[model samples]
Target: MQRQHSFDQTELGTLYLVPTPIGNLQDMTFRAVDTLKKVDLIAAEDTRNTQKLLNHFEVETKQISFHEHNTAQRIPQLVEKLLNGDSIAQVSDAGMPSISDPGKELVAACIEHDIPVVPLPGANAGLTALIASGLEPQPFYFYGFLGRKPSFQKQELTALANHQETLIFYESPHRIAKTLVNMIEIFGPQREAVLARELTKKHEEFLRGTLVELQEWATVDNVRGEFVMMVAGNDVEEVDESLVDLSPIEEVVHLIEAGESTNNAIKRVAKRRQINRQDLYKEFHEI
Candidate 1:
């Protein structure tokens, strides 16, 4: 089926959002190469990182750095180039761009300026993990990157725990173990989950079990490489808000009166509420 949009007469340069491999170079799509080769410029999250892939496929396209740190500054420059009739392509470090990654601002700006943006279907770690996860896919949520800083991370985890859809999260190799422990605490020890690591790579492993079991396994083994976490939807029995043993506000007051520091108390309450600690702290103190 042909796309409804008319591409033949549109003057605005086409912006191709290409998805590269999460792992395994052979996963690169043929159309992605053709698009990269045809575009005037390629906006890469990392030039050095993208160079390896470019060399392998022998794509001679010029690449410029466009990432989270510099996307604000780069958007206008890229827009200007696009306005000048230069077709541009955006690729992330891996998977697709604007997927818990930069490229959103650039895409939005292009759309605002009436630039034509085209998305090329390709590999994505979130969907890759989801399909193989054995979890219900239609009703699901993708929460990417539970980075360091335990307080905020736990808050995000807790919110997802209350969600009815299957939850997927991206976690770093170093933090996966700690994150799994946090998952066990927030979602319960019995939540069935899958941890996919080094997907499509030589040592790829998909560890599936309850949160407690996975935590124990990760603790003993040497875990290295990126991870895609798939956790089953919360059991209806688990989400009865009335069953919450303690109201967050009430818990906050109790902890404060028990001599817990304000910061500690707020962190505890926010986790229970599944809200951001900073937001909770401000509301609690009316800051």
Candidate 2:
């Protein structure tokens, strides 16, 4: 039942969820750097990694370790600091905090204890790659990462198989190839997809193709970079009860039973099933 007036001057301290650059240092926002300079303490996922960013920005603000391994032990200490009117800013190893990052739990804790949580938007890898992907940017589902285990990953992908919105995911260099293979199994070889990596930096690149093509590309000699994968929606039309029992060839036959020409029937069925009309025609006539 708590509402946050983030900018309001209050007795209790605020938790600032700060975002760091995904790759290029220039992408770092002015406000993000300013906030980092002013905050009482910075809770970083990796102090060593964050030191590079802090050093670049000349942000002298002291930092404490706050990452996945020690979150339970750190939250209480952080909460205490915040409760004592010490404004704290939390940052991930890269990109936005609390987004496939470590700040989510602390944000929840602050909310439960009535501490104000203020978020400052900055560089984000998922959206950065999404806009440039040449895919439908709106109606996007930001699924950060899938399960690590093969069985669990497959189960998760299966649940998302029928989703109509553009899908977004983050994967490590080590797992991208296997993940694409799994995607091919669930979403079919023809499904359109894009792979973006080394975002915002000099090595930034986007590999666009179908699931099968990307699967083959993933096995190339060099598969190394932070990856953001974008998958197209399930473009298939609703299965008509009459057409459900028919194969692609049979569906064309059923359509031909009507007054429509064979070519037109194949076109209609292909539109419904999201397959190539020419391919449908060839398969139908060959049978």
lDDT of each: 0.85, 0.90
* lDDT for predicted candidate 1 compared with the true structure: 0.85
What is the C-alpha local distance difference test score of candidate 2? 0.90
Candidate 1 lDDT tens digits, 1-287: 22426276665677899999988889999999999999999999999999999999999999999999997789999999988889999999899999988889998898888788889988899888888888888789887887588888889887777787899898888888899999988887767799998888998888888788899988999888889999998753323354367666667777789899888888766644545667778778888
Q: Write the per-residue lDDT of candidate 2 for residues 14-44, one digit (tens) a residue.
A: 9999989888899889999999999999999
Off by over 4 Å in 1: 1-6, 238-287
Off by over 4 Å in 2: 245-247, 253-287
- Quick one: best TM-score, which candidate? 2
